[model samples]
Target: MKPLSRVLSRTLFYLLVIFVVVYSVFPFYWAVISSFKPSGALFAADPSFLPLPFTLEHYKSVFLQANFGRNLLNSLLVAGGATLLSLVLGVLAAYALGRLPFPPRNAVLYLVLAMTMFPQISVLGGLFMLLRQAGLFNTHLGLILSYLLFTLPFTVWVLVGYFRGLPRELEEAAYVDGATPLQTLLRIMLPLTGPGLVTTGLLSFIAAWNEYLFALTFTVGDAVKTVPPAIASFGGATPFEIPWGSIMAASVAVTVP
Candidate 1:
């Protein structure tokens, strides 16, 4: 009876894993198939798992009509730039906060944590005004800078933990060799925190990429817009109709990477 019960539990666990996998994957799978389906098949009463009557029309429409390539580039530039900036500043700040024996160290770490708790909407108006004053509005640079507000704090918080986990003996060895703090960070500490950097960098990029409100509010037109707002701006011939197929295609494009 015990052996039978153990087998049942294992089977149930596998079933749960399968359910979670399908639940997470189904939406993206549906989008991929929907993107290839013809307009007539798209809204048919009976939808298909396979794109039975497939066509490239929607994907072509996305590239040809929407200036989507430019939008993709803008997103890349903004996300990549923000990630790079966050990692650079995050590493420097983390070293100071985690390793330095300065007073107010705990207070400063708590302050950084508090910054993350404030909702983006709460800061949106002030950020917009500040960007406009700096003439950074309606540009990729503006978007990058705005994203750093969110990304930088997260990067700093996470990296501080990673830096704190390193051995003090390593730093003393570097110092014995006459290495400066910056040199110690770059040569001794940064290499050990590689996994932390990659994780933080990827998260920062994703946050900047998917950010919608700030992207929409900060930019005016398609010329400098990123993928999220650019996709939102896509429309059919009339106000009542939406380009579902085009949206699917665009979603799959952005999601794959």
Candidate 2:
């Protein structure tokens, strides 16, 4: 390529990278800044980029008035439970598909992938009804199961690729030495796949934490509301106003840790 063309390509690539980073991070930065400002400043027409003076009133109000502490705990429990279950099931399923293939393995994998494509909203009413009937409605179990509908498939796929990339000779050798397949899997395969497991677990946890539709549909009371729905349901200080500062504070809190 010509020097000018190469320079242009480099410029374009840098611009694209910068654009993507700003796109993802700017909202987070803005939220954190806004959260520290008072309500008037948060909604200022000429918003200041730098929070010259910061305050924790919003955070205090969120914790004290909104009962965000309890809601946060619920979110932690639901997301944690879902991520754990999905990680365990995803690892086993991915292992079977990647290493110990059974008949029609590809077909089953494709079906699971297809199931992930279905919109979560499409099944919301049915899920709500089923959970209500089973007395799991407004419960942590319901939210965790609902989140699994989103997390499990991608986790399985990620783990499958990671497992498939592994050296299988060790596992076969283990089995030959009278180690059961489960033993080989637990003792050998899992250790080799730690990074991939961590990656998938993080993705699953983020998905469950960010999920909103199922949480809203299944839980109305404080008993089951998670962070997303709790942050969303915020109305302003005057019964009907939007508590923009508190909402931003809660959002920053959620994104931080």
Model 2 CA deviation exceeding 4 Å by range: 1-16
In candidate 2, which residue pairs clash?
236-241, 236-243
Per-candidate local distance difference test = 0.94, 0.88
Poorest stretch of ten by lDDT in candidate 1:
220-229
> Model 2, 69-158: lDDT tens per residue?
988999999999999999999988998988896899889889888989889879888988888999989899988887888899999988
True-structure lDDT of candidate 2: 0.88
- Residue 32 lDDT (model 1): 97
Across residues 1-257, which tens digit of lDDT does each residue of candidate 1 receive?
99999999999999999999999999899999999999889899988899989899999999998799999999999999999999999899999999988999999999998999999999999999999999999988999999988999999999999999999999999999999999999999999999999999999999999989999999998777999999999999899999999999999999878
Relative to the true structure, candidate 1 reaches a TM of 0.98
The TM-score obtained by model 2 is: 0.92
